[model samples]
Target: QPRHSKRQPEWHQRDQDELVVNQPESATLDESQKPAYADQDSGSNKRKTRGIQQENAKDTVVLSKEISEDSKLAADKAMEAMGANILTELKEVQTNLKKQITDQSGLITKEMSEFRKEMGKRLDDIVADLKDVKNRVEEAEQRITEVEEFNMDVKDVLSHTLQLQEDLQTRLTDLEARSRRNNIRIHGVTKGEEGDNLQKFIENFIKTELSLTDTTLGIQRCHRPLGPKPPSGSNPRSIVIHFLEYTMKELVLRSAWGKKVIQLKEKRVFFDQDFPSDILAKRKAYNPIRKILKEKGLRFQTMYPSRLRVFYQNGPVIYNSAQDVSDDMRKRNMFEAAGKPTEDASQPKPGAFSWEGASGIQRWTRETRVKHIQEKLRAFKHNDNTL
Candidate 1:
């Protein structure tokens, strides 16, 4: 039922004729000279028609096969050309990759060598600096040792110098005490009592007080000792007298011992051998004992340079200091504890021979002696209250 284009047998003949005409091998013929199929027999005509149809069918088949062959050849040619172009591009890419890998490897090797050299140089410099530090440390240690030795030597020198200074001070004090030996101090004397002629005033004073007109007592100089005047209402300053001979000073001092006070123009004066400041300080410690000895009518004298000498009937007892005298009094038991008289009346009196204790030896310690002196003072106070 669908309509299709109808094929014409004459069209195929015409195409074949055109092909034959264009060929040099084909014959040229007129239409009038061609055989007429209408004038032939029916059997012969049928054969001719069948033959023509078969020939036409053969020509169509040949044409279709030729066309298919040509198409297949064209497709093969195109495929080969495209494959060649792809292969060429792939080869070029491989070459470029190889060149890039070579260049990068060379650059990395060069940079590594330079880095190694720089590290080696820095390590060498560090070693040198450490050696210099070590040398400086050793030098500092040496200097410290020397300084310590110098300090020790300086300390020894200072200690020796201090000891020498103490020795010098002791000798100087002794020299000063010796210088005052030939002089006497007349205490409680009114200022200006010497009048204008100081020498004549002293000569008259000795003659009148000691009744020494028969003896020749040589006098050298007389004056008020150097010092500020006493405050108003206080005792006047003493007259210091120097003798031509030390014997004359001793004579005047001995004669004035029992006479506790001397009178000069209605003023009570006292006489003492001149002593240095240091010895006077030492003598002040003996005042308590001196008062007791005086009341007992005991004959005791302070010897040259602050020594005390007591003349007992046996002989003389010399003491270097007031502590020595107190120790002696303690052992002798001259004053009893609490000031009561000893019950043993057979114990000789204070001025007797027993005071010279077994050829004058001490048996008590310093502390015991001090305790005895305190008890004696207490006993004296108690006895005076009872009286």
Candidate 2:
């Protein structure tokens, strides 16, 4: 039912007819010269021409087969050549890639080595620094330990020194008090009352004023304390009397105390035992307590070297320091009657014995002792260094 072109078959038939008509003259005679057997000859000639055409067709088929085989061989050879070229190019590319990979690997390995070395060096430096710091810290700790030990030794030395100083001071005070034992101080006498003969004047004055019948009063020496003469209207300096006999001195002092109120030239006079300036300061600190005792009608006696003996209704109590007496008065609830302690009683004079310890020795305050120790230590260390 579909229409197809028939021009190919027509062209093939026409080509076959032309091939028969174009045959050579040797193969076919002219029609005019043919015998009466032309029909048979023509049949035979057609058979021969057909045979030749068959052989030519066979040869053409063989030639076409050979050409197809040759063309396949050529095409196979060309494909093989092209494959070889592509293989060579692939090998070159592979070689280049391998070289690049090798180069990159080497570079990477070299860089890694450098990085490792640098890190190792930095780590070493850090380790060294840590070691240095540790050593310094250890040294500082050692120094601190030494310093603490030195401070302890210094404290021990200072404590011993303070004890020795206290002992020295006690001995000195005792010596001074002993020196002043037999001396008596007379006050309220006008200046220059003894005139030229000091001993004669004192002997006559004591017998007359003190009512001493003993005319043979043994006297060693007598004089005013070394100082400038007092101006007019001022209280005269006391007369210090040194007697040869201690008993006679005691007798004279007792007589003066018994008199209570002695007058000379219309002026009231007083007598007291001569004491060192330091002991006097310590004794004077008791004035406030003495006044309180007097006001309260309590009898008390002052002992040698700054001591107080209170005669209470219950019993007699002795105190070594004014602070102790004040404390006792406070305990007895008698301090309020006198108000607060006077400055002299509360604050002691410098270089004055304020309080006595259980050992009967006086001590400086803790702060004062430490400060002195530090100064001494500094001086000692400086001396040692200089040596």
User: TM-scores for all candidates?
Assistant: 0.41, 0.55
Per-residue lDDT tens digits for candidate 2, residues 207-283, read: 88788966567888898898655668999999998988888889888988998988878899899999876677678
Clashing pairs in 1: 338-379, 339-379
lDDT of 1: 0.68
Stretches of candidate 2 off by over 4 Å are 1-137, 227-235, 344-387
Q: What is the alpha-carbon lDDT for the whole of candidate 2?
A: 0.79
Candidate RMSDs in order = 23.1, 13.9
Most TM-score-accurate candidate: 2
